[model samples]
Target chain A: MADYKNNTIPGLIGFFLLTYGLFFPSLSAEWVSFIIDRLQESMEIMDSGQLLIASFAYISRNALLYFLIYFSTLLIVSALTKNTDSIAFSFLFISATLTAVFLINEFYGESSSYAPHFFSLGLLLALNSYITKQRYYYLTFAVILFFLITAMQCLNLIPLLSQWSFGADDLAISLKTADSFITEDQLFTALYFVLFAIFFLIAVIFALLVHLFNIQITTLKRFQVQEKELKETRFALTESKVYEEIHSLVHDLKTPLVTVRGLISLIAMKYEKTEDKKLQDYLTRVDHSIDKMNEMISEILYENTKKEIDVDEFLRYVISHLVLDDQKIRLEMEVQENLPYIHVNKIRFARAIANLLENAIISFEGKAGFIQIDVKKVNDTVRFQIRDNGPGIKEELMQEIWKEGFSTKDSSGLGLSFVKRVVENHQGTIFVSSTPGSHTQMDIYLPVSSGQGGAFYDIDHR
Target chain B: MKKSSAVIGCFLAGLLLAASPFARPDSAASINSYPNLPAPIGEETILFTSAGQAPENLLLAKMAEDLHLEGDYRPRALASDLYDYRTLVIIVGNSPYGLQYRNKTFTEESDRIKQLLNEAELREVPVIILHVAGTKRQDNQTVELIETTAPYADYFLGLKSISSSTKIIESMDAANVPVTLVQDLEDLHTPLNSAFR
Candidate 1:
């Protein structure tokens, strides 16, 4: 968790002090063994027991040296750059793994050999960060650091390391040096270091590449989700397109129909004056068909585009305009006075609601019946329930009731279908239930307001 | 570039003269630990980060070679060729197992490991995970996943002792392959950890 570069000195001091505390005598005695070991083969300066003691002493001192350097470096680096950026995580993981490897190698490893595990750990950390987010220059720096490591390690793994003997202390040639005491085998060791360095560096690069691929694949999935959302938003916008096309079609038809009607009336008036009863009757039929077509177009346009009008005002307009068969209708109305302004296209909602009420009014088959209309705001919801005491719809026809043109006593089949569309556009739910003679009920649930200034809401059916 | 040239020189020289004159492959190739022992080829060993050290990588490589498997020092590279070989040695990667090591988010890097482990099962590859493999339980999902995955492994060897009954310490029971503790090999140097090669 710590990233320090400058604080490493104190950290190094603390680490060495801790390790040294565990082996003060041995660390102090390490130099003695080291000196004797150098002159060993010729003079046999140390005995087997002394040599054993010396090896342990050397290992303890090395452990102290490593602990001091690694922890101190970690502390300073982590401290200098408080680990906030994404790379910080990688740094900590690398440092921790390095520390673990160093500790294990220190406590249990051979005195004559070394392990480059921490170097690998460091490289993995740096590579992991670049792969995590794929910033540009990260990989370039990684390659440079790797090259430096390989070059230095080669120096110690091959003969150049062993080429320097007991008398070569004055060489002071390179800080990248291996154990000076083991001068005879230095060449072999240096070579080993170099080969291992290159191989391990390649391995680190390989891990980074794999990490990069996985990140890209995961991002691809997110892009796919965004694409799906875009398609849906476009589909939602299509409603407006269709409505515009329908309006223009109505306007075009109306102009031609008005001309035809005017011409027919002029002809019919002239013909009636000449005592032609047949022509008058035929022209009246033509006039009726044109009136019906105009009415139908208006309803379709109103239903398609949902713009709300006042529920009370819209209700009165529907009753006055669509007075189906006033005979069997015993109309009863109950509505809340505290009702807020509803957002629905007035023309569309009025036609849809009237269509349903008209169905209820005429369902008794021209027989006398009671029709109930209730609109009340309960809690945060406004519910519209219409019930009638008629023979109720036949059980077989219940499912078919909402389908266009499936009406039992119908003219055009579009009325109920239009009602369903308007209700859905207002973000409302509709339910239907019927009992033989008791009643047939059509209930609706809709939100009174949407707050953001639109009558429309997202509609989903599952 | 000079360093590379020096390396090439040393490599040729080392190839010519073996570290010990008698230990050359041509000479030692005939030596066998068992009657059917195969000559050791170039090793594709991997040193994983399990046990927070490179124990998985090092231990797995040693065991693989002992069992006549081919591998090398860094196992990450083998990621590409994982399914190509007859047998492979894997040291489990590092994981935040103990509460002392818990961080904020989950580390699914091991998800790659789990993928390889499953593929190995299909290809009949037997893998060995060290002691740290038994310790990953930071949440319910991980605990469930570990339990789910434990049954798929053909040979599950544990480096340290575990508490579960079916989890024996290496008696070679397949239905309940146990954790086996092997005697330590040469421990590596601490100074070498921070050192270059």
Candidate 2:
């Protein structure tokens, strides 16, 4: 998460900057020593109240110095890496280095008064690294801890500093000459215990705050995901309701279509032997138109009714529905031999193919154009590729062409959407490829039926 | 059994006898080691102050009170405080911490002591130098303060335990200032009481 490989060098640089800034001459450490010396002098002459006030000032000054160095290095590292996690890692690096320095100083018996405070700061920084997600919360806690630790150091309350030369020696010297010094020492010791309790309480409170914040964030994220799912469910429900209404309307229209078809059949039978040939041809054409309307109604109402049919027969049925009355367009068909049979709804699948052909023809705008249809077995699916040389679909409108109401011409835009739905319902995939002002290609793959093929073609003239 | 008890008692007596010389009263030895002052060198109403901003001035003030001597303690006493006092008792010791607390550099402290001593001389008040904190206080800063204030002092009182007491006494003797050495802090009241009226 920290991008360790990329951040290692910058992290190390930050660590060095922090370490050297604290310990280098005329830097934070020297400034702290100067202030400590002044505080020690003040402690010798001041009353109890003045002493407490001076100690607070001393602690604040040292805390501010350390914080400046620390925060500056943190900012520089953050800017260099431009990663949120890197700040935590850099803090960890700096804290560890300071800890090592503190341990070494402690082992050699040359520990400064502030060494324990640095060690405490390192522990807090390590805690910050462990909880990387809550950066702001941990950073605030770390700053507060830094101030408290600095106060602890200035008061000489840390056991190691107090028991050693800096605090103990001064106490021992004062003890020999004044009882008031004893009282001051006892008072500081009590203050130290009180501060220690507060430090522990603050740590607990910080942890609790982080926990509460995490719970709140998790709940918020969960609510967002649920809200998104709810919206999608509502949209799908509305789409299903519309489809149900359309299915009912198409079913109602089929009853009237049957009555008209029956009447035409009866009329054709009565005029079977008429001597006027033009009237007979007109009646035959009207019968054929009635059959086409019936097929269209079936396609809309029973799209899922499927059966196995030969790819060649299916293509033929699809081609028969196309009106190639325009003389300027040439349609070519290529069907590979021994192709697998496809399982599909005859009325719906044929109409879907006819819709694609009709779209290619309309793209020509009455100009001379070529349309190519190819049928082949690709693995287990039969791929039908339709290519047109008319002005191709624009790239930006490729996806829009499949929507239920999208069209470039003065017509209802249901053709491509219906084709896409029919193909998908029969376990097929369709893809379109086009270059603007050049050519458009559509490829549809339908899964091969596993069962034996059968002649299921039905043209109901009635 | 009786003879064994008598032997144990004799061993314990011998141990005490051997420790007796090391445990002699330090005040008696301190008095025997130095000659008493010819007479009380200064009067009451003394001004107790520090030449080097040392806390010893506080201890000297306490010692003055124990001897029923009227005195006021001011670790940072200026030359103006010398007008009402008949005798000035200056504690000579350096504490860098104390100097810093008073916000005075060593040079500034020495100058203040010099001015106070000059004012004491102008007022014809007797100046007594007390160097009670022993060898530990004999740093360069304290030694410089001693050199600065020693020329105007009528008497020099120091703890005998100080390693540089001989040199300090030699300088005071060369300056014809009376020198008194005490064995410890408690022994300070003897010379202090005698020096006050």
Candidate 3:
């Protein structure tokens, strides 16, 4: 059996010893006193051998009564409840047993006073842990048991349960009174049977409660898990929807842009021998717009790569996508060699940084702009600072730039938000600052192995 | 709890005393000099260390030598053993001892040395570690253990080179106990010689 199962035997012995020591300091002497007094009273009625044997038998019987009552309390608890919360109940049961044992060893044994309350509390607590964890069930069981036990006590059914007892005269009178109402042997017999019934009733209630609530708790937990799964499903659906919309939009625009480029090339071919000022300027402007469109499409396609991409590689890819004709727009990076990699969504994050490049390029629309991208590993985080000496975003437009779809141009303000999403996903952050004509700087922060050089303890759920 | 702890403590002390054959301290260990006396006092503290097995006669002989204000060099015959928590207890048995025992505790002395260190610490005594994680078995953890234990000591020393940077000190604790590095040992001579005078 488990440690809690065979607890009563030791508990009962401990209780007996504890109470015996506390109340009856001189236990053996007290028992001798009671036996001697009894012998003196019945001295004339029996022979010496018979008197000696009878007195010894009487003391033995009283000792046996204490053990019986102790065992009976345990049996009642054991039979009535299977839930172990009854440690407190068992304690009360032990206390009552101890008190009852002390009283029995007394010359004039009487009924116990606290027997009903402790038995009620102990049984209820133990039953609470086992039978039902619900507050109402516990309160209800406690009330019902209390009333039932109290009702049994009124009928002289609760053992070691009686009122004031006088001496021998009182005992004789009470027995005679009890005999007149009912047979002497039948008084506690019904109570004993009722106690057994209480035991069985408690056991049955305990089993049923565990059975009912076990099902409820398990069902509740399953439902919570399902709810979490449903939430994740909704998020995944939203992401896929956004992805589908962008992919189709880019695909449809590809054909028209290619046709427009073809027409521009045809015009340039037709005017191959002509050296007119207006024609050259028009052709040059047309070529520049085509370059811009091509770069935008390239950015759109590259942004859709699903795998995690190295941040530095993604930076280089973004620069290449820009199609910079002027060597000045080609960003010079002071990146350290073989830098530690930061976790990034290749497509989405590349798009965000690419948009920053696009803005820098546009700000220099008529004049050449010098853009510099620096990637540094400081301690454990990667810091990417993209600086541009473009018409550094107008002071009034700076705040509105990051607001989604609130772009100065026709494109969505989603680029910065997308960048934010990528940075946040990598347990990092982004910052934007513009000196309004001197330079515009967008800095992104991403952690690399958490500052402890070389190793990160990953709780890998994937 | 106190009685059980005391019992374990006594068992730890008795084992350390029994294992070091040269560690037997005569009552008048003070009236003796180094390299002539069976055991020397007022000498540098010597600690024999390896992996797995606890140094026998580890702390007592040091403490007994220290009582007479001698250079307390406690010698330990190291038995290679490895105690790891994430993995099973792996005994790297390449010591001078002829018998090869696995991860299991070979004797009571080995089992109690760690406790002896803890007890010695309670009394405010410096612990001299002499771990022998040789070149054949060098790693990050061995380097870390060597570095961590070095600072708490008044004069830090090691028997074997754990890293390329650590300088090996040829000075003995007196008699034949060898230490690899003796940081701050030069500063100790003035006070030691004054006491000697």
Candidate 4:
């Protein structure tokens, strides 16, 4: 977007400058006349030095006027239209008319000449350019018009040069022989025509050059966007490959870990009456470690593919499983009735919510705790807020809680980080606020429109 | 009823007859008036650029040349030898730049033109006054030159833009000098041809 804006201003300026350049000769003539009128009051005679200075001043004054007009018009019209093409066309049409009038008035005042012929031809080309849809055709037409006008001016010199070669008497005789003749008038008219035509041709070339530069800028911007997208695709591909290897290694260990848990449960049931406090404590610790490992493996294997999920059903399933595992923690749920369907990866979102519930239950350390979960629609977002009345998180730790490999008390540092990843994968945001001794509230917001969701994840992983 | 119709017919005829003299042909429109001056011969017509050596003299000289008159325009103030020319053409307009080139003041240029016109009068060389292109240098000297010399001109040729004002035309009319107003500089050829013939 920044690149788009950056190129448009130059395009408008180039168009205006070209128009101004084409009309510079006539404007310069006016400047010279104005300066001479002002100077005549103060000085009776103009020395050669003064004359040279005045001539240069005449050209400078015209250039200054052209800049002032072009810049101001560009600014005002650009502000009004905002679209580059609109501003350019408006400036082009106005400038073309002004240039035509200036040329016509300068060349022949109420006299017949070849100027009108070239003027009409140039105007027609410009009009045709307006009708053409392709930008290149428009530019080509403009170039041809400027070149033709210049050619006409150059051609006018042929008759003039012939008359110049003759001596005054021969010229007079030749002029006399001609049926329709204008002597000195034609000379001055043709001279001004050539002058203005050259000015316009130079202007056209400058405009074309600026236009080409604008095109380069636009092309560079597109290239940059493509380069960024290519980098992202490569990174995603590398990450997916690494995850595939890790998932296979962890899958083999999952079977052995499940068999060990089954054998421990069978032995514990057989020796149910044996009262060994140290032995039971050690067994419980082992059970917790195995559960943490399984949870880590499950998080690693999680993939977030977008699909419409019923908020109430997903939350009820998550709460039922969490309640069974931690019977001491009482779960109070408030789900808004007639809840809107949410588009997301249901498994990833449920994991995020379950992580928050587990964190709330752990904060009690086996003491009875109240974990409240609320879900409701807010504006264009579906919001879920989980609150715990256990000893809340410290303010200093809150900032560091979501960092990867940074955990308060964990065997692996993947718990909160995994939760953050799942929430983000569903294009939802999670934030927590706590008053250290009172309570912690973890709020998650997901946009109703799931444009940010990774919809093609299933195809990529498969 | 017949008598009334006859009266209306006579009134309409009177209106057309009155309009006929004012309705000039396209060729004659450029000629304001042509005085009864003799046709200029090749050897007797001399063109003088007065007051500032303005371009008007060269332009009118071209016109005269095209009319087959054998005289080139000259920037001359000393009209003492004017007796050789039968028709004297003085192109008068004051340009400060032209005066600066000659190192002369407007008063000096105006005096020289008055003196030259007096010389032409003394030599009995009929004068044709041309007020052709430009209104830029219509300083006091230009107006003075017109007032002082136009009365003596046998014929006056002016472009429409230059002579649209009745001031100079009225003065020449009082002097019984013929005046011609050309719509454009190109229109001057017809009256000039007639004058040369």
Best by DockQ: 4
Off by over 4 Å in 1: A1-121, A133-191, A215-244, A260-347, A350-376, A379-462, B1-197
**lDDT tens string, model 1, B92-128?**
3232221112221233434545666666677665544
Cα deviation of A304 in candidate 2 (Å)? 3.5
Order the candidates by DockQ, highest first — what do you get?
4, 2, 1, 3
Q: On a 0 to 1 DockQ scale, where is model 4?
A: 0.04
Tens digits of per-residue lDDT, candidate 2, A113-198, equal 44343444444444444345664743664555565455444444332223232222122122222322324245555665577667
**Model 2 lDDT on a 0 to 1 scale:** 0.63
Give lDDT tens digits, candidate 4, residues A1-462: 885565566556656665565565445554544444433321223133333343234434533543333343434344445543443444443454345435533542211122333343334333333323334543544444444444333333333322222111111121221211343335434543566567566655555565566578679989999997786677567767866887798788899999988987886776677798777877788888888677656755656546677888888768766754645777788989888888866556676788788878878889887888899988777889898888987766766676555666764455677777777776777777788778888877877787643311110000
Residues B5-85, candidate 3, lDDT per residue (tens digit)?
322433344344323322423322221212121221223232323333222112223222333432322222322221111
Error in Å for residue B86 of model 3 = 94
- Going through the candidates in order, their DockQ values are 0.01, 0.03, 0.00, 0.04
- In the range A92-156, model 1's lDDT, one tens digit per residue, is 53455345445533543211122233333344344444443444333443444344344333433
lDDT tens digits by residue: candidate 4, B1-197: 33233234433443444344234333333335643235642234565566554423445555665666767566664676565666677776654444544567777777777778888778777787777642222334556677778777888877654443445656777787777776656777777666666
Model 3 docking grade: incorrect
The DockQ score of candidate 3 comes to 0.00
Clashing pairs in 4: B32-B180, B33-B179
For candidate 1, the per-residue lDDT at A271 reads 79
Model 4 residue A459 lDDT score: 8
Q: After superposition, how far is residue A71 of candidate 2 from its true place, in Å?
A: 9.2
Task: State the lDDT of candidate 3 residue by residue for A1-462, as single tens digits.
Answer: 775655555455545644553344234444434433443233223234433343343324333333345444544444345443444444545455555545654533222223333333334334444444544543444444443343323323322222221111212222222221223324444534565467547554655666588779879989999997786577567767988898888878989999998998999899988979799889989889988677666656654323445766777777778767754565677787778766555556666678777777777875866788888886677878888887666667665665445566666446665666656655666777777658878777677753333321111110
